[model samples]
Target: MTPIRHNASGGSDNDTVLDAVRDCVLAVGVRRTTLTDVARRAAVSRMTLYRRWPDVRSLVGDLMTREWIAVATGAIPAREPGTTARDMLTEGLITAVRAFRAHPLFRKILDVDPELLLPYVLDRRGASQEALLELLSGSLREGHADGSVREGHPERQARSVLLIVQSFTLSLRTMTDEDDPDLASEAFLRELRGILERTLTP
Candidate 1:
């Protein structure tokens, strides 16, 4: 993925453009948002936007990449003295699911322009997904070294875990019961935790 364009102080024209794209998507959805609208919001010339992003979809793709990467980075567990890689990876995946579901941009896109995600979901992996898979595979290798995770191809194991996480993050609402007093979604998350544990356990 294109690295987010911001310095230590967090100010850049690219950041401004992506922020405008985010606000436009949140307010009017992706289909309705235009390059002109983003330019206006960013207070930059339309030529400036066109120079960077050819269309709204590409602009939105970059925005989503930035947001999703941030979410995943924040979700990763901090290393400590005795925490096994399996435990860290499991916690990180659960945290990422919760954060993705709660992200305003993610929620807005899923509600108003879910079709925008169909290409990424059905056809090819997005940049964010590739980055996540890299992280997962590295962690799986760590688990193997520590004798915490079962022996397997780390790449395949990471893909399997990503499939499970994607299902929970994207389709979870379909299987949830709003009226259930037991909080079906939370219960299902617990099930997810168990499933990950068993999947990785030696």
Candidate 2:
């Protein structure tokens, strides 16, 4: 669940808590990051922080959600004739994959506490997946109106795309067992992009 964005009493926090969560998670791991530590890092009192989030997990969950929403929103370009819905969707998924690969915090989580990430990915209607599905469904409807997407239920199509994106992007090693994991991961992404393009294109 997302924590309240504002500081105590709705002040101009400007993401101070999220920033603090990221810092604390990086400095220590998720298991060790306490509400006290986050409040100290954010320069707020523990009570003030608790007013927004009950614990560190809740706060970090919000942080991860915000980071992903940023990636998804930034992935799409302004609509134009040349940019079909498929194109926008493909680019957005690629952006997410690349962002995850490059994100220090995400990598840190993977190394320190991959189990923390699994619930969101494994649940069919988890918060993260639902957020992405909502974004994709909106784009699909727009595409249908413009005759760029197939006539179907946008939610179903979006869920399918989300599953594909998550399956391949999250499970990198299954694609290839190259000695250099970095190179293997890149190669896997290239293949994933092609598959998604074919799957989503009308």
Candidate 3:
């Protein structure tokens, strides 16, 4: 059996290892963050980490997911009454994009191994889907009930819009050096807002 660390968190040692993964990812980037390094940072043992995460990629994937969920739920509030659905959505999309783009850890991952981010690209089971689905659900429900978004199907539409937002957000990382990333992002959001406006009434 691998060594395990326990604490008041009461979470599994796997959670501890995952937290350590985040620290190492942020401090040293994914490429250099070894199981040993994570263990050292968490004051756990290598065997403990290995027992939980077999390798850096799996660990990185886990951390990436938690980071997205934390930021979406923690940084943004749910839709409020009298607020246009489009506005809250725009803010949330922009916030998520800016956070991902400005994150040193995420940037490092993009710079080193962009494919790590793609496993969730418009896919059914990954960080992008899970985090966004959770974050958008509340807002969509609110908007639909309040008559902000179109009344046909709240959940389905929310998922579609969120997938688009994530796609645009992810694409920002790949813009040409000569292209202005912010301008491109803004333009994309503008077009997206137009689509949203068409779908929302009253």
Candidate 4:
């Protein structure tokens, strides 16, 4: 684990604490992980941790928001030559889903601390939704300029796409009675891609 640097601004320093939180939660689950443990792992004083986040839930919520935003933003591909914005949006969303699924910390949280995911999904005005909305809205605006995407409010289009992608991505762990998970996943992706392409394309 990278040692967290103590910084007054709490910029990258925040990532350091979040890293420590991830380590603590992975090793001792969410229930057992405490702010004290995070402070120790981060090599920062409890005072430092407390100076920023009031409680463990608040800290973890920030961590989740940061992690999800990182995955979403990082998954956005550069505008490739000859690729339409619609194509880029689809690819970016698919890439984000893959990244979310493959993220070790995210998977561990889902397995051991699933409750951490509830607030983000259940609350309409949660940080997770806001972060995703910002990322998706930016991408939709690019698509609109490229003329590949339907002309509409980018925020509205982004919300529609985010809801669809969130449902599919979060539903991964809930699959039941699958004879071949790979085949099932491929089929699902095929249908999802078709629907998104039709809906998003002009």
TM-score of each: 0.92, 0.86, 0.76, 0.88
Model 3, 129: alpha-carbon shift in Å? Answer: 2.2
Residue-level lDDT tens digits of model 3 in 1-202: 0112222122666677778787887777777778888888788888876776689887887777666665555546466776675567656666676677777667777777777776566334674365466557666776776666666565677677776666666675465344676677667667766755665554
Candidate 4 per-residue lDDT, tens place, 1-202, comes to: 0112222224878888988998887788888989999999999999998888998888877777777777877887887689987887798788888788788878888888887777667865566677677767776787788788888988888789888888878786576348987677767777778878988988
| lDDT for model 4 | 0.78
Prediction 1 TM-score vs. true: 0.92
Give the residue spans of candidate 2 off by over 4 A: 1-11, 78-81
Top-TM-score structure, candidate number: 1
What lDDT does each candidate get? 0.88, 0.76, 0.66, 0.78
Candidate 3: where are CA atoms >4 Å away? 1-16, 78-81, 84-86, 122-124, 173-180, 199-202
Q: Which residue pairs clash in candidate 4? A: none
lDDT of 2 at 118: 84
Candidate 3 lowest-lDDT run of ten: 1-10
Q: What would the per-residue lDDT of candidate 1 be over residues 1-202, giving only the tens digit for each residue? A: 1123322113477888989999999999999999999999999999988876899998998898889888987888888899999999999899999899989999999999999999988999988888888888889999999999999999999899999999999999988867982388778889999999999999
Order of all candidates by lDDT, from best down to worst? 1, 4, 2, 3
Q: By TM-score, highest first, what's the ranking? A: 1, 4, 2, 3
**Model 2 misses residue 191 by how many Å?**
1.8
What C-alpha lDDT does candidate 2 achieve relative to the native structure? 0.76
The worst-scoring run of ten residues by lDDT in candidate 1 lies at: 1-10
**C-alpha lDDT of residue 62 in model 2:** 78
